[model samples]
Target: MSIQTELTEQLNRYSVDFIRFVDVSALPEEQNKGFPYAILFGIALTPEYIQEITNQPDYIQQKIKREAIHRDEFHLKERKTDRLADELADFLTQKGFTAYSQSEENLAQTGSYNEAIQQTSLPHKTIAHLAGMGWMGKHDLLVTPEYGSAVSMCTVLTDAPLETVLYSPEESMCGECQVCVDVCVPGALKGKTWNIKTSRDEIVDIAHCTTCLRCLVMCPWTQRYAQRPVAVR
Candidate 1:
């Protein structure tokens, strides 16, 4: 098998729900960090946890409880993605390509903020969107056909000339669905549709967002993902 195909098949063992290779040369140097290629991958959140969060009472006490669940799961899944990215980077390095894994720790140390774009360094969702794995949702989250926004993503950059699938940037598939906007208690969601030029702040106000995950839980696409059979997931 070709190296790309072999590595892709190996990702199953790493619990990757989706993976894509994309050329990021067009991105700003600050974002791509001079890497021409990026591996963008995501791991879907546990359906059971999502269901619990979605079905729980919205009272303050219950909201806090579900928030705790959301926080813990996010950290757990983020760590898993971080480790997977590091492993993939090492694998590519062994294959003679210079690779750099974008670890949470490294990003944290670098303070993550890209002042120009008003976002964190090398947004994983942007790469995922470029890879045709997803589109930016109304809530400013990457909404995938398979996992919706219920996924944790990470990135690995390399100089390797790996295979890629080119696609035009996707427009919002959200249509008139305003479930996320209506469910957002903090009024963070703007109910706006996203396009290539839309900035994240245009969809949601980060300052007002409580990170309570109400938007995520109420999303129709995410609900569909949560309803999928466990075995199939």
Candidate 2:
């Protein structure tokens, strides 16, 4: 079996639900520019847990008050995401693929289309390009059909020469759905195009984003399972 196939199978054994490969070289072209690796996986989180966090009275109150608790909660969530990135990288590297986590510093340098797509010390956009995980949204975030703009992404860069999965570039799905823009407490998601820039020039503007997940959890498309009526046993 091909190495890519083997790797995909191995990742699946660990409960990784989706896997896709992208050629390292194909990423420099206009269609694939900015990234250098590709793979996408999601671990299912209970809908109840997601709803609890989003609907928590304290969570809503903190966001409304613009309190420090918002920062603390987001930091905790980010650390968990970072740990997942590390674990995935370790798994790939152990399998003899030269894999590493894409650095935050590298991400900062690759300014989204809202600004100019600047060159970073290490370009890692290939992962996003190859995974077919949706295009660069107007807000400079990766939007997926299943997750909308709600998914957390982590890159796995590898020397493994894997066959690439190609997907047609999708039009912005935020079409006329300004829930993200309208509900942004900090007014970060502004304009018809959903650009990510602020007057302060912060690339990501984490401070502005309370990570309230209002844009995420509140997304109509994100709660697909929640909409289904419970199956009475």
Candidate 3:
């Protein structure tokens, strides 16, 4: 097998789903146009996991206080996912490519305000564009036949030349589904355009997002769907 395929296989051994290789050398010009390549490791955070966290006193207290927890505690259950991202980075470094985590802050720093605005559209759309996942819905989350939006994504950037796979972008499947938009307490979803720029323009007085995962947790699409086991190949 080729090196990239071997790498994908190795990643699969860790139960990573949807491994993709992205070539970002062209990003300077594209400027958030989309990545040339990206490795998408899918993680399904089940309702059980959510319930467990919700049951924690500290988590409940933090939620009540509307405070953000420290990263260590915030991602306590996601350590394995973070490690996967790190391991992928290390592997890419060994292969002579630079890699870094693409956090929201990182996105803001690299791209202009406009670029960041564009990113808020939908994670699944971005993933699907890279052929890492599938189409999204009005809830602004990706929907796959298997996993719904319960999947978390980690991306890997590399200079390595790898074969690309193409999947036609799926149409928006959220036909007349305004449940996500209507249920948002802070009204983050304003029907017209979900871009960050439009968001800022709509509510300049709002300081920050409510961070309420109401939109995330209340989605019928996510709750009703049966998740595909994301085992590493």
Candidate 4:
């Protein structure tokens, strides 16, 4: 089997919802840390959990339940993605390639989502966009056609000679969709349309966000994921 195929198969064995090998050499050298390639992968959050959080009537109660779900379900999937990253890195190392997983450091900062975003040198959202797994949403989250923004992502940097795709920063797919912006109680979303040149701060005011996740829950793409027939895993 091809190395890329073999690696993808292994990731699938671990229930990775999405996987991509991408050439990250286009990123600033300091950002990628001289790694020519990266393995980007994600695990989806439980739709039922998201639905419950989305359907809660009381805003305060929704926030409370969202925190519990983030702690139990979201972080648990993050840990799972971390483990998969480590395993993939080890697998590459065993084959005489240089590999490093970023999951452990990112997980350490998972106590606060905003903190994690602030501290990450190469955000997984950036990597996911580079990998063509998704586009940047108006809410500044990576919105995949499949799972929307409901997937927790992980990354592994490597010097392995795995085949990789190179894509220009894709144009945003979220055409005129403002559900996430309108639902932001803190008015954190600026209702800006994203393009390759648009900065995260242009679309979202992180300082103003309370991380209430109303945007995440009300997002139409996320709703599609939640309402889709459950797959028998």
Per-candidate TM equals 0.86, 0.64, 0.67, 0.84
Runs in model 3 lying further than 4 Å from the true structure = 22-35, 50-74, 77-80, 98-100, 103-125, 192-208, 226-233
How does candidate 1 score on lDDT? Answer: 0.82
Per-residue CA lDDT of candidate 1, range 205-231, in tens?
Answer: 888877777788678898999998767
- lDDT tens readout by residue for model 2, 46-128: 46645665567256556557866545444444444445556666777777776655535234444422224333432332255
lDDT of 2 at 191: 38
The numbered model that scores best in lDDT is 1
- Model 1: what TM-score? 0.86
Q: Candidates sorted by lDDT, descending order?
A: 1, 4, 3, 2
CA lDDT scores, all candidates in order: 0.82, 0.52, 0.54, 0.80
lDDT (tens digit, per residue) of candidate 4 on 47-154: 986887687625444546677544557668878888888888889889888887878653455431336445466778899888877788888888888887898888
Residue pairs in clash, model 3: 12-232, 15-232, 20-38, 20-39, 22-37, 22-38, 23-37
Q: What stretches of model 4 exceed 4 Å from their correct place?
A: 1-3, 57-71, 104-119, 230-233
**Which stretch of 10 consecutive residues in model 4 shows the poorest summed lDDT?**
105-114
Give the Å shift of residue 28 in candidate 4: 0.7
Q: Which of 1 and 2 is ahead in lDDT?
A: 1
Query: By how many angstroms RMSD does model 3 differ from the true structure?
Result: 5.7
